[model samples]
Target: MLFVPLPFVNALLLALVFVFLKKSNGATATRAFLMLIALCCLQSIVLGLRWGYNVDALRFVQPLLAALLPPLAYESFRGLVDQAAPGRFRLAAAPLAALVILGLMLAAPILLDSALVLLFLAYAVALARIAWRGPDGLGLARLDEAAAAHRALWLAAFCLCLSALFDLVILFDFERSGGSHAAILVSNANIVSLLLIGLAARTAGHAQTETNTEPEPAPQTATSEDAEIVARVDALMTAQHLHRDDTLNLSRLARRAGLPARQLSQAINRVCDMNVSRYVNDFRIKDVCTLLRQDGITVTEAMYRAGFSTKSNFNREFLRVTGMTPDQWRKAESRDLEQKDRMAR
Candidate 1:
């Protein structure tokens, strides 16, 4: 009555969801997605054997499977977030093959428990590395709404890793105390972790499809009207310093430029090669640099005068464009100014 069939039911559900996602969207065709589903299925099968068939031997399989799943899931989600082509066998095949070999070694029931624990620890370390690197090695700013969705997926993967770590701890406790409580605890933990992983898979699949299918906005063809529009917006920005307004939205900016909102959006996207927020931030960041360098304004005051609502958003956009923080920009400017001062002296 340990609800033995539950794991298989979960596995089948995961498999069905994955297949549907894969068929519906090419973007979801990622190794991470496939591997995660496979991991769930394997875990379910092993758990069913342990429960229904009284195959105590299947217990050794859990740690190895758990060890590999999180990092692979993290890596897959990372690739999806970045919109980069995922690596082939290099990413998942090597570790998966190793896990299979290790599982075979454990088949004899003579495997050293310490070795298996170490393997699990090593997998955890690898997962920690993936979490640290984040999406695309570009850090958080590069993550758009789609990338953020994938980041949330990675967070779920982290939780699964934590659950596995907890299982290892319980196993250690059982080893010392000669109790069967760890087995029950691990079974319950698996059920919970499997549910979490299923949710992550669904999210990742949705994110992939959503990101890939989103149509790119049409570019504005250069025309006399386009030039006039740019000139008008540029004049307004120069005159009113609208660039400094952090709350500057599309409608307001469109009104200032004397163009309709949709046309204004099209013009900026076509001409400037960025969205309205990014377009505004580009000028704001430039003004911030100028104020910091020429006027010796503090970053906070510069940010406010440039129209940014918050320092955090300012820093994020600044880094997105310049590939450095405002503080970094200030320091670099200071160094250059110091050099100029020395020459003057």
Candidate 2:
């Protein structure tokens, strides 16, 4: 039997995930997410070769690949919130900096290791800043999927920070243990980080399908009344049934209302006292309630017709809005109708 390295298995699993995402998402997978996953797979393979197989030559290549991961993960997530974010050239500086560090490592090997730790920590902070805005901050993600995307951003940030910690642990082990425990620590810890980053990339990939080609309008900074903004959005939702589009996002809504995404979100937040996703789901739940009261419609049908994509979300939102499950609400509504019929008779 051939001895298969654990890191090699990790790489193959990531490869499978990459293929699964490609097949499932097709063009909907953003280039950044695809690149992020591909790099993870490559890094895992390099880890396998260098540490598992004891190939000393790959030491030079591994850190350079590590340099690319954080920026790509950050870019993958930043696109969810900011449509007008800086281009890839700006992020390319990380890998270029890594290249220079790689050269410096010949004289001071710790240079590359220390830089990788700091690079991961920096991008982790960047990712956490975006996630700190909550689901509404992901203005470009579909309203139905923003929560999931937000969670993914958080996990990605945590994974980066954890990766940095793992590097630090490996550095400590080298100093204290003559690098005795380095292989186990690297194989177990780093592989898990790679898997988590891949999963986060996959979770956030769904937002890529809701692409908008229209250039985002400049945000309006005028002191327009919040009531006026709410009225405009309400009128738009009523007249155009914008809430019926599950792909509706804050950016698109802001674009339609002739307001900036942040400004619109702030208006909704202040006026409705709820996040934009919750506010929009209120409209959807209202429509679902109306449909549930009518005959010839199933709960699933009502959920889909009212712009809900998943039963779990639909049921959760329904409960939040109505204080009852869909079934309970329908039964209670039926009893009210029966009582009305009896009184009329």
Candidate 3:
């Protein structure tokens, strides 16, 4: 009888997710997420080898992989909202820093663990700050999938923070028990953390497909700048039906409106009193309502016609905008029309 380790099972799960994402999106997904998932799978395999098979060589490799995860998580999400990434030197710095810490592990092992805890916590806080801005913060994410991306941002932050906590627990376990509990603690905690981080990164990558492009300058106006921006965006939305593009995002919408993404988001927030996702959904829901009112149009057809890609989002936005389900709205409309017709007769 062969025994398979849980970490190998976990690695298999992440591999499946990676394959699915690759097949679904091809090269469109941010490479950072793909790297993150690949690293996760590698880390899982390393863990399995070290703990399950007691591969002594992997004892040194584990911390290096641990150091890479947080930075990848940060880069994956940073790419979603921020069009400008750090310079090449800055990009090289993270790996260099990780290597420095790995070197320190040879002389002072505790320092490596402490640095990992701090690194994870720092990235967690950074992710949390971005997520605090709501879905609009994900300017590159599609309007329809922004909510999922926002949730994923929060989840990624929590996962990083949770990884920090588990490291602390492992440190205490090592101090109190000569690292007897380290295997079980790391196995269970890291498996959960890695899976969650993979899921979050995947969700974010799905919503983030836009390449960096220079945005057109917003019109310079003496007054009512927000209103002017909104008016221009509205005209674009109405004339081109930009809202009907299922892949539409704040960056794309801003580009079409000839406004910077941040400026466009802020203008919509002030003028419409809603985030970009909600404002875009407002247009989609309104279009869906019109479609629903027409004869021979099914609810699903209405949803798709109105640029809603998911039934849940379509239903949610429909209820939010119309205060009723599509069928209920249709029935109410029918009843009202019948009453009006009888009164006319």
The true-versus-predicted C-alpha distance at residue 217 of model 3, in Å, is 18
Task: Name the best candidate (by TM-score).
Answer: 3
Local accuracy of candidate 2 as per-residue lDDT tens digits, 1-345: 787889888888888878877876674546678778889999998998888889999888888888888888888888786657576676566677677667767777767778889989998999998898788877777787788888999999999999999999999998999899998998778999999999888778765544332223223343458779988999988788888898788877887999877777877777777778898899999999888878899999999989998788888899999999998999999999999999999
1-345, model 3: which lDDT tens digit per residue?
897878999999999888877876675566778888889999999988898888989989988898888878888888877678688855975697678778878888868889889989988998898788788877777889889999999999999999999999999998999899988988777899999888887787777768433222233442388988888888878888888898888878877887777788777777777788999999998888788778899989888878888888887888988899988988998899899999999
| Deviating ranges (above 4 Å) for candidate 3 | 211-223
After the best TM-score superposition of candidate 1, give how far the Cα of residue 219 lies from its true spot, in angstroms.
29
lDDT of each: 0.60, 0.82, 0.83
The global Cα lDDT (0 to 1) of model 1 is: 0.60
TM-score of each: 0.48, 0.89, 0.91
lDDT of 1 by residue, 35-68 (tens): 6767777786777667646688776665567556
Over 4 Å off, model 1: 1-4, 23-28, 57-64, 81-89, 96-148, 209-345
Best by lDDT: 3
Clash number by candidate, in order: 4, 0, 0
